[model samples]
Target: MTRNVGGIDRAARIVAGAALILLALTGAIGAWGWIGVLLLATGLLSVCPAYLPFGFSTCKAK
Candidate 1:
């Protein structure tokens, strides 16, 4: 898939994902927080399926 996630978006995802994961691990947000894995995956892959349906892209034009 194309790299549709831009630098800022990637960074935000990383931060948000990490925080959610940490919260889950600490029992602060319950198991649902583990869903952060999705964010982490999207950030790492530089693609978001949800964004696809809407034709959204955070990446700069190449």
Candidate 2:
């Protein structure tokens, strides 16, 4: 997939994802924290499915 996430968007996602994963691992967020794991995966992949239909792309055009 093309990189639809970039710059601050990418950094924010990474930070959010990492925080979620860390919180989940620490059991500070409970079972709902699994959602954080998913976020982490999507963020690491740099592909947000939700943005597809909306035609949103944080990446710059070539």
Candidate 1 regions with alpha-carbon error over 4 angstroms: none
Provide the clash count, candidate 2: 0
- Model 2 ranges off by over 4 Å: none
- State which candidate has the highest lDDT: 1
Task: Please provide TM-scores, in order, for all candidate models, with all chains considered together.
Answer: 0.92, 0.79
Per-structure clash totals for the candidates:
0, 0
lDDT at residue 6 of model 2 (Cα atoms): 69
How would you encode candidate 1's per-residue C-alpha lDDT over 29-52 as one tens digit per residue?
A: 899999899999898889999999
What would the per-residue lDDT of candidate 2 be over residues 38-60, giving only the tens digit for each residue? 66676788888888989999887
Residue pairs with colliding backbones in model 1 are: none
Model 2, C-alpha of 5: deviation from truth (Å): 0.7
Best by TM-score: 1
How many angstroms is residue 24 displaced in model 1 relative to the true structure, after the best TM-score fit? 0.2
Q: What is the lDDT of residue 2 in candidate 1?
A: 74
Name the lDDT of candidate 1: 0.92
